[model samples]
Target: MNIADVDTPAVLIDLDRVEANLKRTQDYADAHGVRLRPHIKTHKLPRFAKRQIELGAIGITVQKLGEAEVMADAGIADIFLPYNILGASKLARLQALNERVTIRVTADSAETVAGLSEAFAGAEKPLEVLVECDTGMGRCGVQSPQAAVELAKVIAGSPGLSFAGLMTYPAAGKYAEAARWLAEGKRLLEEAGLPAKIISNGGTPDLWHAHEAEVATEHRPGTYIYMDRYQVEKGVATLDDCALTVIATVVSRPTETRAVIDAGSKALTSDTLGLTGFGHVLGYPGAVITSLSEEHGTIDLSASDKKPKIGEKLRIVPNHCCVVSNLFDVVNLTQGEAVVETVPVAARGRVD
Candidate 1:
């Protein structure tokens, strides 16, 4: 079908751009001898996950158990869950997921380790657990290298768990510091007679710097699959590199410099990412998505002399693409203005 025939406030994925992004990232990783186990949170589609593997990704990463289950059922054999699984119900689900795929998990606290042990104590095969380190991001990881070693020991001694390695989500522009921290953790682990099998760190913000951390064996990049406004602003990707764009129709031309689009928080999402506006309106460089109501997006066209007429269609690159992916049940795949296909976002509401 022609792109013009599609409805407004629609999610569009450029098939050519998606294919290029996948191959570019995988090629970069392969050249550096770094494994690409892409995080599935961005696309959340089994087809893209399989494509990543076909392009040489060792495995895939999922933030939630629901996502892992979806990918596992889709025949993705190797998966990584970088978050700590606590509650008994979640642990049971994780165990069930592990039964079908070769899955690894991460833990930052002894409490999480204990829970993992209790759940997998009598299992046939032990679960591989990685020690999550703070490494300057100051998120969900151990504070120091010593703490990482101690946690590794706890994981190794657990009945149904094995120490996999170290993992961290480093601060955006601080790759060197994070690398030193991981290096220390690696040294400590080796000295303690528990050498790490995998030292991993990831963030799309500092993707090109992955090689700086020589201690890392693999890298996880999620947003690279669908470049967004945030990625473009960070200079990590160019506007042409983005594969996802929301096609919204102009619904109002209120005054001289003001216009409204059909896309709003419900469709375009309300993620600013510290940017001055909500999203970038393609073909309207002067337009700024000033504000968004539940069903309306206010655009300030004051920067440009021209004004969009009511009912005019516009393509928008959202501030954050990952969140936008979940806002829609399905996304349209297009090849140069032709709507080739539409696929369900398999892991959209998989928040568990």
Candidate 2:
């Protein structure tokens, strides 16, 4: 079926671009001698994850246990969850998942390690735990190199946990700082006779410069598979590099300078990521997605002389592709301008 025949407010992925993105990033990782563990958060499809693995990805990174479970059920043997997994109920799920796949988790504190220890205790194989370092992201991670070493020690000493190494989601443009932080942590670990097996650091913005980290043995980049407007704005990817777009039909042309599309926050996502507009209108280059309601996307066509009329369709490159993927239950897999198949988002709403 042609993409044009699909209903409005549909998610579309270009197969060619997806293949290109995968090959390019995997080749980059190969050339640098670093393991590419592409995160499945961007495209929650097992098919894509398998494709990534086929293209040379050592494993797939998932943010939640639910996503890991879905991938594991799909025959993905190696999986990594880079978030702190807590609670007895969630640990029970994690334990079950660990039995099914080679699961590795990230922890930033002794408390989290203690919890993981109890969950994987007396298991056939100890769960690998990576000490999350706060290189510069200021998110969920240990504050300093010393804290990272301390946590690594805790993991190494834990009965059911094996210390994997250091992992960090560094802030954009902070690769050097992140490298130094990880290197120091590795040094302290060595001095203390603890092995730092994997130093993983990643972000699409710093993907190309991943090798510069010098200490990272693996890189996890999610959005590189489906470049978006934010990645384009960050100069990490170009417009032609974007593989995913929201196909919306112009439902109203209230004025020459104002138009509305069927896509809204529900479809086009509300995250601007400090961008000027909601998304980049493909055909209408000058149009700005001014606002988004539940079911409508308001576009300001004041900058363009040629505005979209009622019933016209426009493909939009969203600001953040990962969040957009979570909002849809299915995505149209297209080859060029034709919709080849509609694949269910296997890990949608797997937040828990």
Candidate 3:
């Protein structure tokens, strides 16, 4: 089917651009001797995950068990579940998944560590655990390198848990500091007779700066597959590198300065994240997405001389691609203006 024939408010992935982005990111990681584990949370489609792995990604990083399961079930052998695993049921599932593939998870607490170790005691292979350091993200990791070392020591001594390495999600611009902290943690661990082999750090904003830091041996960049408004706003990627967009039909032109499209909060998401609005229009450079409802996206098109007529299609690049992807069960794959195929967002809404 032609792209124009497809339904409005549909997510489209440009095949050529996506392949180029995958190659660029993968080549950069290979050149620097750092393993690239492109996070599948951004795209969620198994076909894209296979493409990334074929492009030289060491493995894939998943935020939750469901994402991991989707990838694993699709024949992805090496998987990393970066989030801390808790609860008896989740641990049991992780242990079961370990029997089929190489599964690794993060930990920041002794109680959680003990729980995982106890749960996976009889597994065929030890559950690989990485000490999660906060590194200024202030989110889910432990605060200090000393604390990370302590956790590593505990994991080393645990029966079913093995200290795989140190992991972190560094805050933007904190790459150098995070690298230092991770390096320190590794040194302390080695000195204490516990060696850390995998020092993993993840963040799309800090991808370029990953090599500058010494200890980061692997990177987990999810959003690079579909560069969005946030990455463009932060200058992480240029407009040319953006591969995904919401194709919306201009359904309303009530005023001379504003036009409304059929994509909105449910389509683009409400993640401004210091940006001006929900998304940005490609051809209409200066126009801003002023307002968004569940089924409508309002754009201020007064600055441009050309106006979108009723039924005209326009592509809207979302601010946060990850969240926007989760809202849809499938996305249309296209080449230029031609529709290639429709791929399901296999891991969408798989929060578990």
Off by over 4 Å in 3: none
User: What would you estimate as the lDDT of candidate 1?
Assistant: 0.92
lDDT of 1 by residue, 113-184 (tens): 999999999988789999999888778999999999999999999999999999999887778999999999
Clashes of each: 0, 0, 0
lDDT of 2 by residue, 1-352 (tens): 9988989899999999999999999888889887889999999999999999999999999999989999999999999899898999999998898888998999998889999998888888899999898888889999998888888888988999999998999987788988999899999989988869998888788889988888889999999999999999999999999999999999999887999999999998999999998999997888999999999999999888788879988999999999999999999999987899999999999979
Query: What range of 10 consecutive residues in model 3 has the weakest lDDT sum?
Result: 208-217
What is the lDDT of every predicted structure here? Answer: 0.92, 0.92, 0.89
Better of 2 and 3 by lDDT: 2
Which stretches of candidate 1 lie above 4 Å from their native place? none
Better of 2 and 3 by TM-score: 2
Candidate 3 C-alpha lDDT tens digits along 151-242: 88888889887899999988877778888888889888889888888999867888877678768878999999999989998998988888
Candidate 2 clash pair list: none
Once all C-alphas are superposed, what RMSD does model 2 give against the true structure?
A: 0.9
Backbone steric clashes in candidate 2, count: 0
